[model samples]
Structures are given as C-alpha cells and as structure tokens.
Target chain A: MSQGSTRKTLASIAHGRSGDKGNHANVAILGYSQDAFDWLIGFLSKEKVEDYFKPLGVTQVERYLAPNVRGLNFVLKDVLAGGSSASLRSDSQGKTLAAALLLMPLPPDCPARLFFKG
Target chain B: MDKVRIGNACGFWGDDPQAPAHLATGGNLDFLTLEYLAELTMSILAHQKAKNPQAGYAGDFITVLQSLILSLKAQPRLKMVTNAGGMNPLACAKKAKEVLDQAGIVRRIGYLTGDDLLDRLPDFIRQGIALENLDDGRPLEPFLSRVVSANAYLGSEGIVQLLEQGAEIVITGRVADACLTVGPAAWHFQTPLEDWNTLAGFSVAGHLIECGAQVTGGNFTRWQEVPRYESVGYPIAEISSDGSFLLTKPQGTGGLVNFETVAEQLLYEVGDPSAYLTPDVSADFTSVEIQDIGSDRVQVGKAKGRPKPPLLKVSLAYRDGFMASGTLVAGGGKAREKAECCGQIIREKLRQANALPQEFLVEILGAGDSLPGIYQRNDPPEAVLRLAARDPSKGIIERFTREFAPLVTSGPQGITGYTSGRPQVREVFRYWPTTIPRDLVPFQLGFL
Candidate 1:
C-alpha cells in the first residue's frame, strides 16, 4: 500500500470480451487509454490471470500482446470442458471469463486510477 | 480508386431475418453476404437431411430472400452471396430461385458444392488420409459410425468463378465465411487468385463484418456508446482496389462503427491475432491498422498476408453422448447454501439410482459462482441452481433430468422454480476439427 493511493477493480481501467476455441477460451482485455494499456502490460501477467481463473481448472494460460488494439489476449486452455457442443457448464464458451478477470483487484498505487474519478 | 461496397446482414442462420432487406435497401452496396453455418449447424442440418432428402440447408435464407425480392429489384446492380446451404446447396438454391421467380425477377442463382464430406469419408480413409483431430491427434476411426456431418471449408476461388460467370446470387455450402466477401472483392478488383496481400485484406474485411452487427457495435464492451438498438444497422465494408476499406453501418441507423467495435470483432473467436488462418489466405491481423475515420465509419487497412495453407480445415460432428440440464430457483436466507444443497440432493439421488454421468456440473447463477471462484460474493436473496450432466448412455441423462422436480417438494425449503417440467435429454453433437490436403476434396459449381 502506498500513501494517498486507492485500490480498485480491473474493470475500472479496462474492458474485455471472451469466446471459445474448442475446449479453450480466449479473453481479450482492452485498456481504456494508452496509459491504462501501459499499466496493464506490467500488472496483468499470464501467471496472474491463470491464478485468477485457477478454479476453472485451466491447463495453460498463454498471453499475447496486441498493441494494435491496446489489448492483451489470454488464451486459457481446457477451460470450457468440451466447449460449445459438449460442455455442460452454463458458461460453456467462457463468455463471462473476461468479466470474471475484470474483477481482479488493482494495486493501491496503480497509476491507471488517474483516468477514473470517485 | 474504384471501390465495391459489400454489406453483410445475417451473420448466422438465426440472426435477424429482416437485416438482409434492411441492409440491401439502405446501403447502396455492390454485394450482400449472408453467413448461416456455424460449427455445429452442419450436424443439425445433417440430421434434418437424414429425415428428408431435400431439407439439409438453412431454411431461413429462403424467407429472407423472399423479403429482399423488392429490395433486390430496386437495386439491379446489387449482387448477393451466402453459405446458407449447410449440407445441401442445390436444395437451398432451388428454393431461392422459386422466391425470385414468384417476385417476377429474372436472376441467375449460382451454387457451389462438394464441401460435404460425409459420403466421401470411406473414400478418404481408403486413400490413406487420416482424419485425425486437430486438437488431439486421435484418428476419426472409433467414432466413424457415430459421425453425422463433415464438411471442408472451401475458399473464394469458386465464389469468384461464379461471380465472374454472371451469377447474380451465389449460394454455397461450407465455404469459408470470409470468402463470401473475398469472392466479390477479388472479382470486382480483378485481383489474381495468388495475390496473397489483396486476398488477405479482403479476408480481413470479410471477417470483420461477417458477423453482421458485431463490427457495428452489437456486442460492444462500451455498449453505452452504441445508439439505437431498435434497429442496429448491419456492417458494410466499402473496399477499394488496393485492399483498404472503411467499415460503417447504414446512414441514420442505430449502432456504431468505431476502432473499439472493429477491434473487438477482430479478436472475436480468433485464437492467434498474428496469424488468422483461412482457406483463401493467412491473414496477419497484427499488422492491420484500424482508424476511426468518421462517425460510424472506421478505416481498416494494412493487413499483411501469407501463402494459403496446404490443408483445408474440416468441421466434423459426431453423436458423442446425451446431455440434459434443469435449473431451479433457491431463495430466502442463505440462497447460495440452499442452491448447493439442492445440487447435492440431485447428485445423491442420481448416484443411488446408479445413473452417474460421465460429466456433471452444478452452477449457482446469481451467487457469482458462474465462473466458480472468480466472482465470490455473499449469499443474495435468491439464486438459480442449474444442474447439468452428460453420459454415453441416454438412460443416464434421462434419469438426471428427472431429479430436478423432486427437489421442489423433498429437498431444500427454498427450492421452487421448476415450472418447465423435467428437462428433455438432448443428443450431444461433439465437434471434431481437422485438416485435409486441399487436393483431396473437389470443388463443384452449378446454376439453378
């Protein structure tokens, strides 16, 4: 915790979308601004995302940098059971995976908070 | 530079049926594309075909084309392309031709076939072609008897061929969804079939608007920015000869076309951004530049392309097992606890009956357990407890469906919401994605 700093959820700084590829699901988190994108590049690592979605029994989490869209895409493997057809989960395609990731708490001193107002 | 504007109104079979007429009449376009088939849609159509010989295609296209007859007549130059032919292109084309004839419009209806591989599976096997799964390298032998539908994704060459041969309306089966756009763009610009860069650019544009409203702010994350949902206009790609294009919706129509909306769609259902593989060309989406040129208009250009893959991807669906799910509402006090308790009761009863399924899941909808541990929160006033299971045996799935009703009277005090009766057991159509050498499957084109 830093002096005069506040903590917030990742949703405050970024928005995302997710879809399925067979049993795997890919979630793309796009930062609201260039500063937020830079901040996300440092804070949102693959291990952190994997840990966040650990309850989903993700086999592997691979992250790809998309500076073009100012986004980071995380491909969570074996997370959708058997995906669209065979998966029994209500969120079979992992449509809400991005919304779940957005719930991750941001650090107290995260600089991206400047874009948002309380 | 001369440009051809192509608008896609229907993304899939069940998409807004009125959109094709809306886009055709509104956007002064050169071509209109309607994509219908998804991965599992073919299997469904296969089942339909098995019941009736001439009933394997997307029937929605005929209804939509009938509505678009006046619009098509109004814009004489407006051509249309679609893959509404799921397992049967000839039947789809025949129905479409009847619609045009009834409307007193004389237009050539061209169709492309040979993508359906169900009949040719044994031939491929005899030729030493192993139709192994792309995800897991298991050969498609053990599940051969259970296989329903198999179709190879064809490319834009046949589409372009049809367009060049003066086919005003092109209907196809199992062609790459993007090829619906690529075919028209390539034919319009007279681009060589091997011009990977141009072909890739068209492919990217096709991919962007193929889902209709997706590129036009349908599922946008910043949904507030999109105005007028009552009639969100479909997407239009105003493409030029050099492979650059501007994406926009119809004038005065609701929905927005911006960098964010376009970018979001670019990532939709795509695995690797750098290399988006297709039958026509390998598109390098990483190099693609999206610029918001104006309100409801975004310019997308500079998408690099590589040589097309030697293999064509095939979508194979088989009867894996049976699945059934039922949901009940749990409320009053600790709703989460009650929901879990109800789930347990169902599982226990199923176990006692010796009807344990291969896969089972219990989801507490409103309790933040939809993604399980990701959204942990305290119990709310009410929550939906959904119980789902899958098994190789239909008897087990049918047994699982019957367990939900008993929870209302016997299990938790809060359990109620079972008005829909027992959930019906559905046959699980498992998907198998694989690739085959391009030369193996032949492409056929015809007119109706």
Candidate 2:
C-alpha cells in the first residue's frame, strides 16, 4: 500500500511485454486485426483506460494473437484479482488489469465473440 | 512399511510395444499397471462391442499379457491391474484367463464388472435421473438413441474387492486413472474412507503417474532439455504410509523428473484448483506443493481433499449420425486470409447447393496473424489451413465433403493436399455426462 512498494511492483510488472502502472494492475489484449487492435492500443494507451482500471485496481495492458491459429492470448498483470486463476470474491488479488481489454468493440461479424461469450 | 513398487508400461494401445518387457525385466516391480482407455476410446470399443460381445476390450492388452507370460510367471509375487477392459471387462478377463491357461501360468485372473450400465439405461431414466451434458447442461433425451457406451468411473473400492477375492490379475472398465494407484494404497495403508487428506495424497499420486511418463518428464514444455527422449521412462510413485510420495522413474531410463512436468499434469484437464472432482475424492490442487527431490525424482505433498460430489460423472456415448472429416493443406502468400475466405466459400457453396444445415459450422485452423504478440512474427512465410464442419443430416454431411476437393482445383490455392479423395460422412454419437443417485445405482462388486 506504500508509495515505494507500489512503485517497485509496477516497475517489475512493467518489465513484462505489457508495461506497469504505479498501483494498478497490468492487462494486455491480443487481437487478430488492426481496427480493433488499434482501438485496444488507443484504449489501453490512454489515461481514461488507466483511470478506469485504477478503480478496479488495474495497472497496464498487453495484447498478442496467433496469426496461424487466428487465436488471441493475453497477459494481465497486477489486477486486484489473480486474473483467471482464482475466485474473485474470495481473494483481493483476483481483480485484473485486463478488464477493459474485454470491453473493446469487435469488428462486425467477428468470430471472437464466440470465444469471449462462450 | 516395505516399499511397494509398481511399474507402468504402455500408456495406451498405440504406445511402444517393448515398454512392458523392458519394465518387467528391468524393475523390481510388485505390480504392473497398464492404462489404455480414454473417453473417445470407449466409442471405438462400443463399435466393436456392437459386432461381438467379447471384442470391445483393447486387443493390445492380450498381446502384452501373452508377451509377458513367462516374465510374469517367473515372478509369482508380482500382480497386475489394468482398465484395459474397455467396454467389456468380463469378456476381456475371460480371454486373459484363457491365455494364461494356454501358457500354463495358472494364475487366478479376475474381472471387475457392474460399471457397465448398458442394461440399466431405462431403469435409470424411469427413476428420474436426468442425464445432462456436462458442457451444455442439456438433457440426455435428444441423443439417447445414439448412446454407445455408458460406464461409471468407479473408484479403487471395486478393484480392491477383486484383490480380496484372491485374484492375481484384475481387469476393470473405465475406472478412474488414479484409482489404480489408490487401490494399492488403500489395501496397504488401510486408510479410513473419511481420512480425505490421505485419499487426496493417494489420488494426487495416482494422477501424477496415471499418464505413464508425464510426471517423469516426457511431456514437459522444456522437453529439449530432457536427458533422453527415445527411451523416455514411465512414472513411478513411491508412496509412504504418512501420505507423502516421491515420484521417480527407472534408473538409467530416459525422461526428466522436475517441477515443470509435474505442474503440467497438475493443470491438465483441471476445472478448478480447490475442488477438482474425482471418484475417490475432490482434490484441492491449489493446496498441493511440488518440488524436485533430485534428478528423476519429484516430491509431491500437501494435496487436500474435500467431501466428494453426490453424483458420479457417467460418460455415455450413443449413435447420433454418421460423418467423417479429411484435411486439405492450403498454402499461398496470403494463406491466413485465404483460409478464412475458404471457410466462407465452403459454407456459401454448401448453402448454394442446399446442402448446408442450420447448424453447419466451418472452423479454419493454422491461419497466421493469430496471437500476433506472442510469436512476434506478424506474417509467416506461409500457413496451412484446416476446415471442419458438422451437421445432423448424413446426406448433407456427405454432400459437403464433395465440395473441398473442387476448391483445390479452382480455388485460390490450386495446390492442395486432397490426394485422399472425398471425406466420408459418419455418424456423430452424442455424449452424456450426468449424475445418478448413489443409492439408485449402488455398485455390485464381485470377483470372477
């Protein structure tokens, strides 16, 4: 909770492909295309997305996708929760930085919906 | 307690044939366990069962037993347990006993039955146990006709009954993989049923070694760093009465026993870490700790178990409809984009010919530009495209198969791997996994 420790944790997480935020969690959303990909970069790259993440205790965003499989794999860091690993209500670490990554709009008639909603 | 050593050979039917002989001759094993069944394997066995009652079990089990007859006879103290029984444990055991008789081994072979619920289907339905699909939670009524094999994943108690009956070789159907290990532990330690932590430890040990070589490092992500790949050794769980275990492999054998391999098996097919469902116990995988004991050895401890779920997961596969699929390679400069476009083209073609059904789906595989960040390689030089679809209508499925080959001759990628000809349309039997009241389907254990 201290400023110095928060700074160090942020720095450590930022060292990942997805950089770190001061006290918030880090999240990355990988995509199959540029329109949504650009939006994600713009969204996570902006201050509003950063501020929105702080309320839920998110920190940073990183995204990547497999060109061969048409599949996207993401890494969310320092979310209030441990991301998808553990139960949310039970653990404070369960909050995730990649929460906004899921909210980004998708291209019309995209197959990604089948994955997220399914 | 004296060390109870069990060797596992032949992870599946298609596994290396020399594994059993090497393990039997090499290790001072008290028991040899061979696992040869998966959920999909039962369907193939059921297809065989439909033709002949005695034809469902793995034929490779007979071959392995015949090969090991001399070695097994030489070591009278060594026993064997396996679920190679597949859909028909009794038939499999009968055949094994006949083999032993012919070999003059004279060992008392036993068959563990009552797990096969083919005859009790209507009784279970009438009693109001709604068999639902685990993935979708749909009732089993829709695909009941296509049901091929229905068997409960019975625990070690069933296998233990055979040991009590003086059977040297016990054959079972669809028992949980870990149960093979737990049965020996229960018999040895006499651990009470309510002592769940011990059961959890036993289950975890069984789970680690069940896949044969997984815990011993065959499937580790860093397999390249592994010492020996060609002679990769199967796993062995050296358990203690206190419920801790040291996992290792045979001396001088191939494979790595480290943290990574154990972790992979821990995460395999896991739904929840705290409440992993199994027949013997609901293991808390999260609580467990894994550490490398030494070279080719892992120490696993602290796995906790909770009260088991009320209902057992029964995998029942019935005949739905027939369908088949074949792969065609698509390659070009823009293979990823072309593959996606090919999926759309196939569906449009099927719809145009009035062959595509409402439930038709085409999935494209190996499309580059997917997971763009992980690989960090934006444009692959080229990629292979795989397209698959399914439909209830057999004729429609058959019709859709004819559309792929023509795409190669006329489509963007004129060069394709369509030498196999048209895909065969085969029936897709639906699967049912639901819970039945333990009281209603009380297991009847016997030794034969």
Candidate 3:
C-alpha cells in the first residue's frame, strides 16, 4: 500500500463507464496516455478489481486488453445483483461501478500529480 | 462512390421525442436509423399482440413519422432503417405506409420478417437443435412453457437485400442494433459479403452512433467536458468507401465529439474487444482507431474483423415473477437511521404475519445504495426508504405493495413522502440470452 507522498488514484490517469450485459457488468477504464496505460496494465490486476468490488458481491473479474484505445475492460461477473430485470439496487445496471472503481487507491510509488490535464 | 452520412435519431423506445424532427429537419443524412427495441421490449410488444391482432409494433414510430414526413419528402435521397417493428414488422410497416400516404409522399417501403422464433422453437427442438442458454448450459425445456417472446438476431443480409430491391425504407424485426448501420453501409458501398473488414468497420461505426447521442457526449465519463446538453446533438457517421468514417453531428448543434467521447463509447456494454460478434461480422473493436480531427468531428479508421459467427444471438424473455417497489422519504435529522428503522419495522411486520416475500430488498436512496457497501454517505438531511420485493406468488408481491403506505402512519417521526400510495405489482419478464444457428433463421424481406 502507498504512503502519503506516493498515494495516487485511478482518477489521476484514467476515466471509465460501465453498463450491464444480462446479470454481468463491464467496467472499461481508459488511460489518459500511453505512459499511464502502461502503468495501468501492470498496476491494475483482476485480483485487485475482484478484491475491490468484493463488498458488492462481485463473484469474479475477467480483464481484457484494448491496446488501440489504451484501455482495459474488466467484466465484473454477477455484480449487478440480478441485472436490470431483477436487481433491486438503485443502480441495478452497475452504471456507477466505473466511477466507484476510479476512486481506488493505487499501490506505492505512483505520481503525485494528476497525469491528464483538464 | 461518395461518403454516406447516416444519422440515428431515436436511440430507444422512450428517448427524446423531439430528436426525430430535430435530426430529420436539419441533418443532411443519406439514411436515418431509429432503434426502438431493447432486451425486454419484445415481451411487452408480445403481450400487446396477444390482446389485439392489429397491434404489436412500436406505435411511436408512427407518431415520430408524422413529424418526419415533411423532411422525408424534402430529402428524397434520404432513406430510413429501423428495428421499430418489435414483435410485428408487417403491422408497423402498414401503419408507416398509411402515414406516408396521408402526407402525399410516395417512398418505397419494405418490411422484413422471420426474426421471431417463438413458434419455431418447438420445431427446432424436435430436430435436435438445443436452444441452450448462452450464459449457462440450461436447456430451454424447463422454461419452454413460460417463454413469452423469442427473437433471433437477424443480420444485415436481409436489410441489404431490401435496399437492393429498391426499398427506400427498411423495417425489420429483432435485427442487431449495429445491423441498422451495417446494412446500409454494405448496400451503398456494394461491399462483398465476405468482406469482413468492411462489415466490421461499418459495424463498429454503427455501434457508435446507434445509441444516438451516446458517442456525442451522452453518458460520457468526462460529462463535464460536454456542453449544451439541453440540445445535445444526435450522432452522424459519414462513412467513406474504404470503411473509414468521420463521426460528428449536424453543424451548429449542441454536444461534444472528441477522442474521450469516442473512446468511452467504443466499449460500452462490450466484453472482449477483439471479438465483438454480430450476425454481419465478428468485429474486432481492439483494432479500431479514432482521431479527434476537430471540434464535433472524429475520424474513425478501418476496423478489423473475422468471419461471422456460425450462430445468431437470441434475446428471449419469459415470465419470472411479480415485483413492486414503493418509496417513502425520511427527512430532517438522522434520516439514514430513521430509514433503517422503518425497513426493520416492515420486515418485522411481514415476519409476524408470515407474509414475507421470497426476495426483499431495502435501499436508502440518498445513502449511496447504488454502490451498497462500497460507497457510503452516513449523514444526509433526507433519504428515500425504498422497499422492493420479487416473488413467484402474486399474493406475496401484492401484499408487499401494501406494506409501504402503512409505514407513513405507523413508522419513524421523520418519514413522510408516501403521497404516491402503494406500489403496483407488475409481472417481471426476465431476459434469457441464447443463440441459434444461422441456418435455422430464414430472414425474409418483402416490399409494401
């Protein structure tokens, strides 16, 4: 885990959006640059995402690479409760999962400043 | 061969009603696409057809057509492709023809059939075609009787056939959403059926603008970067002969189109980017590239693809159970605590009466129930105490609906936003995703 000086978040280098596919949800996080993308490919792992979203009952996570877009799409399986038809949650489709994931604290020795300019 | 401009006006059944007229009147489009169906939309249209022989299609297309009449007449070169024919394309096309005739416009109309597979499923089963669920290996046997609507996702072949037959307008049932753009691209470009790269490029473009304003800033991750959302422009993909396209909106319209917007939409609801399977082509979204040339215009390069999958995906809906949700606002101080108490009180009462539903879910709206255990905001001035229940027994759901109103009079001191009364118990038609072999579907195109 990163200390105060090295602590960083995905919001510094990436942005994403999520939606439902049946009961499953896909959260795609795209890097702001190739450097950020390279850092993300190694930093963000399936086990990390599965661990982060475990509180929401995400059974498993499958990571996929989209090098053309410098993005990684993580499919959070069975995380939408029962998806649109049956999920009783306010965001039944897992539309906010990406936003929630972007807030995850990065591992140690990350950049102190945000990577992408506004 | 010149570039083809395709604009999608209607994203779904209940999108902005003003979008059709806005795009039709202003957009210089060769083709206009209206996507009206979603996963469970057919089940609803099926229920409609069961009650009335004359109704099953998307009626709003007729209402929207009335607004597009003048534009369709003015732009004679512009054609329309739509899957607005939910459960019934014939009825929808007939209604559309009547609307056009009334407007004194004589454009050729076509309707495609054979996507509906409910009646044919039994026959396919007899022939040893196991319609097993794509998600799980469960055979359709146990849920056969409960199936309400089953439609195979037809590809662009039928749509292109209709266009080749000199049909100015194309209406289809249960075609893939991307096929709306893919069909027109293949017809206009005259691309070979085996040209998977070209089809993949068009399919990728179609997926971009199919959701209307999605690629042009709707649901964008950087929503703050988008401007003038009140009049957000619909998307237009000016596709070239070589499968490259410029994604933009009508000039002077509101919305942002850039690399960020384009990149986010490329993977919306998609799984493996390398194998984005459709009936037209198995597109590789990973090979697609985008360049933000300027404001409100992005150049999307040629996409890669493989041969189409042997089978077509099926979207089936069946009777799941009855469910209802009712909300009450717990206000002032200690809103979260008060809402929690109200939920406990309801659960206790349900337990005492032995009328507990099979599934009972309680959510405090303002307390970050969206993320549940992850994101939380403990102190809020007010919060919505929502009680939702789903069960096989109609009696259980009906009883669950009654429990909300009683909370207003008997529960916490701050609880008081139940003016809407008890929730209505409605049938839940859960989606069942599966696939069938391409040979099993006989998608036929006919002129009106």
User: What TM-score is obtained for chain B in each of the predicted models?
Assistant: 0.97, 0.89, 0.98
* Pairs that clash in candidate 3: none
- Clash totals for all candidate models: 0, 53, 0
TM-scores for every candidate against the unseen true structure: 0.95, 0.74, 0.97
lDDT of each residue in A17-78, candidate 3, tens digit only:
88889889999999998888888988899999999899889898999999888899999988
**lDDT score, candidate 3, position B157:** 91
**Candidate closest to the true structure, highest TM-score:** 3
The interface RMSD for candidate 2 is 16.6
Evaluate candidate 3 and give its CAPRI docking class based on DockQ.
medium
lDDT of 1 at A17: 83
- Candidates in order have lDDT scores of 0.88, 0.63, 0.88
RMSD of each: 2.4, 11.8, 1.9
lDDT tens digits by residue: candidate 3, B1-448: 5999999998889998789889987788999999998887889999899899788899899999998988987889989999999999999999999999998999899999999999988888888877887777888878888999999999999999999999999998899999999899999989887898888999989999988998888988778878899999999999997788999998788889998888989999999999999998899999988999997899998798899999899988889898888899999889999999999998888889898988899989888776877765567889998889888999988887888877777888978988876798888888888999899889887788
Ranking of predictions according to DockQ: 3, 1, 2
Clashes of 1: 0
Ranking by TM-score: 3, 1, 2
Model number with the top DockQ = 3
Model 3 TM-score, 2 decimals: 0.97
Q: Which stretches of candidate 1 lie over 4 Å from their true place?
A: A1-6, A113-118
Model 2 - which docking category? incorrect
lDDT of 1 by residue, B1-448 (tens): 6999999999988999999999988999999999998887899999999999999999999899888988887888889999998899999999898888889999999999989899889878878888999877999888888999999999999999998999999999999999999999999999998888888899999999998898888878778777998799999999988788999988989998887888888888777788889998998888898899888889989888999999999999999999988899998879999998988887888788888898999989998867777666557889999988999999999888878888789987888899998898988899998999999888999997
